[model samples]
Target: MSLLADNGKTSNCRPAFVCLLLFSLLQLPRPQYNLPFSVLALFLCGVVSLSLGQNDKAQRDRLIACLASLILVTALLQAMLGFVQALGLAPQTYGWVLFTPGASDVMGNFGQRNQLAQFLGWGAVSAAYLYATGRMGRAATGSAVLVLALMMSWTGARLPLAYGLGLALLAWFWHRRVPQDETVARMARVLAWSVLALALIQIFNQQIDSVLQAIGLPIHVQSGSDRLLDAGFGARRRIEWSKAWEVFLQHPWFGVGLGGYAWHSAWLEAYGGWPKVPESWLFTHSHNLIFQLLAETGLVGTLLVVGGLLCCLLPYFRRGEQTVDNLLLISIAMMLLGHSMFEYPLWYLPFLLMLVIICTLSPAKGWTVQLSGRFRQVLGVSAGVLALAYAATGILPYRQLIQNFTPRNENTLQASLDNAKRSLKLSELSRNPLWSWEADLGMVNYLQPDGIMRDLQLELAERVARYQPFPTVLIKLSILRALNGQAEPAKQALTMAIANYPDYTPVFQHELARYREPELKPLQEMASKAVKAGAAQGGATEAGRLAAVMTVAAPATRQPIF
Candidate 1:
């Protein structure tokens, strides 16, 4: 393929612009999962529109090949890392291949296996593309098989591995049934040899455990087993699914609204408590994508999501163009389907991006060519706006990192520290923040001293009081005060929490235990003295004096102070 055709102009930048806009929208909150389809759709629209302006067969081939190669390389690297981790190597900090520990297992480190599966699916497609283009050899095919095997086993992501193996077997069976062209027949033989080599490696490897220990590493254990036991043979997911069905029954047309499932789930849990209801009744997710979509977006929104998927997949399937791109799209769709059986795959960014890339490569129908001069101008403006937005969002994490890492001794560090602390605090207040309040509270205790931490605790208590109906926040505030050695305040906060949530006996017991610690004696003595003084001045009633005395005296009878 030629780099550029004679008539094809390089000046048309609409495709790049559209991609930028779509990327920005994907970064938005609540409906973040829809970003991939949005990005892919916008990009494809650009590509199709651009293709209308000129004809350049070589350039088109080159562009497709380049994109295919990029996708292949990314997949290869991710697979390699997954394999290395599976072999019991700790994830490398500085390497071409990167793996992060997830969920106390290889799969957990990556947050979800769907992304890795999508990557492998794309890699398989890339390999298939090479074979279709008569570029794959026996050696290349063998290497690809080995890599795929490693990815599947090491990552502990069952879905992608299963899908890839199934597809390969189906392809082998189909190729055997149909009389293949000599070239395709040759490629198939090479693929067969590669599979044979992978089998040999597996045979020699013995136990997966022996291999890990031989390399001075311990075996990776997944939390899924424990979660399964806790959930009663996947009954937790079944419960969530049942609730989603009820939601669908209630709002069969338009969903309650985007991000509304968590709110609705409280009622569901109140009625059907199969899974042990969490102290704080928060919906992790619908756990089923289709159900989640139905519950969140309703029927009309579900249709849009379904339509987007069809628009992304139908083109390549109809054309019978089993190019690397088409394979990626199919694999991603399958992977999503698999992941949706257990997890809400759209929550993560990388998986979402994989979906977009796959959809972008899929063929579309009835793509009208309405590229007028004015429309082109709008495209340029939109692209510029998107570019700026992407830049801003990309920089936020870095800014936060800098603020978080600033030295405490520096004059300006206090302000930065305050900001970081406030960010954590605000996230706690929002209730639906990205992280758990326990985690945020831990950060505050670890980073700040006792005096400043006490002030923050007081502020948090006040904030929780304002949102009095929400007992979880109040419980957390009480815990924070208890940890900071503020017995009186902690008791007051716990009293409020117990009143709001009388059924939460464990929380009350936990706070009472903290009051009985010996380390709290100094504070208790001070509180007791203040109470007696107030009583003498007739400032405190008999009940108030008794409450104050109980707060101070209870710990003295339990344990000796250090």
Candidate 2:
């Protein structure tokens, strides 16, 4: 289909545009929170609307065919590599190729193989559709079968292989109901044979290999199954979920706000003894997205998110377009589920953008609108303008971060630190703090002891007065004061610090050791003498009583003043 024709009838445009805007917004270096997901739901709604529209059927079909071909080609290549490895041949690694490891024994690099296997899965779905639809040639069909077998053997990715088999079986069971074209029937036959061959090979090679090992003719090698055991591991997830529930209970309404997960977790750790509370253990999100949403955004926000997903899924499901939609839907579902196991994938702008694109491109229908030539031109210009604006916003902050941190720009670092301090002060005054308070602390450290002594001292005093005293900060303050000849005050501070945190015996000992220096002894003796003289002058008063106590406590070898 021509571009104009595709644009005219396809419901994809509205959702695609919205997704593009959201993607651009997320890519803006600042924190966007839920805007990306919100926009994505709207995009999905557009797709749903378009799918229900009467126009653009031909255009949508053509796009699906093209996407299927792309997926087939990708799968075919991956399968070929797998076959090469199965034959004990080393496949040429391309620099441009993104390789993720699958099974360590079958594919040496696990991460690279895993990525390849995921792509292969996508390919398998696409290829299955192509074969079932009669879009693939005989040669391509045969090649795809061989590749699929190789992929199954080499990668050992059970999910994709299982999915492929299921798709094939479903296709075969419903073959009679499909269109009566000769090409379609022949394609279906090919798919059935391929799936059957792959399943037999897997069963015989894997299941039969163990039995055959007794006879010394092992056909399949087993990779160690530690990962399989770990798959059933639920303890950590349960703990995280429980903790998230507690957080939700604490902040039931409006939740903790955006970017509050780590801080909240830290707070929870401090009070409740959760293991996830160290300086290094910075957890920005809950492992489960739904739980994370509930914790961070609260019940109301979670309802909106659930409602959004339902709204987007409604139209496509109602139309019974499950077969064609399965590939895209499964991909999204797996990715979302996979992220819940370890990561917050949506935080990565590129991944989020790709998700938006895939969700928008899939579903084949929803809100269709025809645009005039002038309007189309205007849309193009608007997209460009938005992209540029987003790029500019992202670049500025990134550039500033680099500029302030570079080794050669020492002056700039100091200036930046000063600005950060000013901003922090203003924030405290306005009661509206920015998220980057650590930036000020970083700047202070960068300036070191000699460069910012007065400022550091002032800041420490302010911090001690305002915030609850922490052991490390108190120790640092004591050392700073002692070095500046505030010995008595330093000792008093150290005493209080030690009393507050008795666990910090080493720090307290170190501080006392500093006061015992030969040079410091003369100063201490002079102070003692002064106290004794004051006691003689004001006998029996409170200050005189303390001075007399000091005089009596002085050691004989120290040579007390008359």
Candidate 3:
């Protein structure tokens, strides 16, 4: 079947405009998981609306197939790049494929190891769908499989690797729901063989590791573990989900405010005894999707989301016509739901975009529920205004930083300060305290004090601590107190910093401990200066003295600084 026919049946401006508005709400926050994602969402919103149109199931299905094909192609390419990098046969830094910080694992484009894994898993499913339905050739399918196995295993992303055994089961189950019994059989064999081939390596996992190591492609030790369930990736995630649940229980109806999880995490850990994860690890979302919605939007929103899913998915279970598109969508939907239990798949906009498309598509036309004509018009106009505002307000500060970026230290500092001030103004206009917090931090890091550096640091530290007493902020406050001659307050601040992040105290101690040796004389001298500046009785003083006296101190050595 052909895609995008010559005859124009409808103007999709209304739906497209409404989508733009829907996406604009996703922005309006700093350090956004990646602002470019928002742009992509907007473009996709327009394309999906204009191209797919309302009630055109065939076009929608074809589009989904084409997108799956694209995903397959991308997976093949990423696998190739990652394999080359892992083998040390090619440069790793080329393009967006950068080695993760501190770890040798390479991720393409996403910059995160886990995200790359999820994207690759999506690719794997996409390729599997293409081949199972006969849209993709055998040679292409085999090549895709080879690359996926190598890359997935090499990156050692826990979810994809450990969940290896589950993929085939998913494939068999989803394919059976379709009307074509032949396709179901084909899919079962294909998926079972593919999954089996990947799983076979486990029999000689050690030998495989040895071979890869010899060739410098050793699987990453951190993520490659076959350990099924991390008890939710250690206590950190356990505590995060725990707090979110407690918060949800209290506000079972409305839950906490949207975008209120982080603050509540801090509050719960502080007061509710919800088991904080060594203040070094801060949580943003609830980590679990259901619990997240429960804490943020309450049961009302959660039920609405659940109802929508039921609307989209219940049809598959009932006996009816089913196509390859329906099969792929259901598989992806299931994968996303399962992955969301351990990790948030929808937080990434690309995955989220795919999800929105798949979940919205049905044998029937239009969305599960349609907005009224007047509401659509109003939404369109409102969306346009909000989109423009979001783009202008958020991008302007970063634009200044980007455009004025200079190699010269003085120029860079001034440019940064300018952007900080600009961002501060935007914060005032938008009433988002995060912007102001960002501006103050920027000023502290870059601009000349002009005389109020102390005030700025103190106020910034106080303001930030009030919301979330992140160890970094506390450390800064401690430093400022020491420099300002408030020695007792400095010690108190330093104590709070260390006590708050017990896990990180060793790292902090290492930084101070470096000053003990003569080789670290510069740091030693600096510490001495800080101590002489009236921080004489604080942890800084003891650390400096110990660092100066101790000839061989390990960075991980812990002392009673806190």
TM-score of each: 0.59, 0.51, 0.67
Report the error of model 1 at residue 205, Å. Answer: 7.3
lDDT value for model 2: 0.47
TM-score quality measure for candidate 2: 0.51
**Better model by TM-score: candidate 2 vs candidate 3:** 3
Model 3: colliding residue pairs: 516-547, 516-548
The alpha-carbon lDDT assigned to residue 433 of candidate 2 equals 24
- lDDT tens string, model 1, 1-562? 3212233223342332344344334323333222333343444344343433232335545655666577677777776556555644645545443445462245423544655655565565556556656666656755775676555444444454345454556446435544444544554454454445434433333364566677976655332112323433454566677778778889897666555666456444433333332233345466788888788667766666666666656665553464433443464466666676677766665565455545544455333344454554455456557756666764754444445433243449776777567556444433523222333333333333234556765665544343132445555555556567666666554544432233343433443344655544443444445345434545344343333333322222211110
- Across residues 431-504, which tens digit of lDDT does each residue of candidate 2 receive? 21221333333232332222356556546443432222345444455555655667875554443343333334
lDDT, residue 193, candidate 1: 46
Ranking by TM-score: 3, 1, 2
Q: C-alpha displacement of 341 in model 3, angstroms? A: 1.5
**Superposed model 1: Cα runs more than 4 Å off:** 1-63, 83-104, 107-109, 169-208, 215-233, 273-283, 319-328, 373-381, 384-389, 392-562
Q: After superposition, how far is residue 383 of candidate 3 from its true place, in Å?
A: 7.3
Ranking by lDDT: 3, 1, 2
1 or 2: which has the higher TM-score? 1
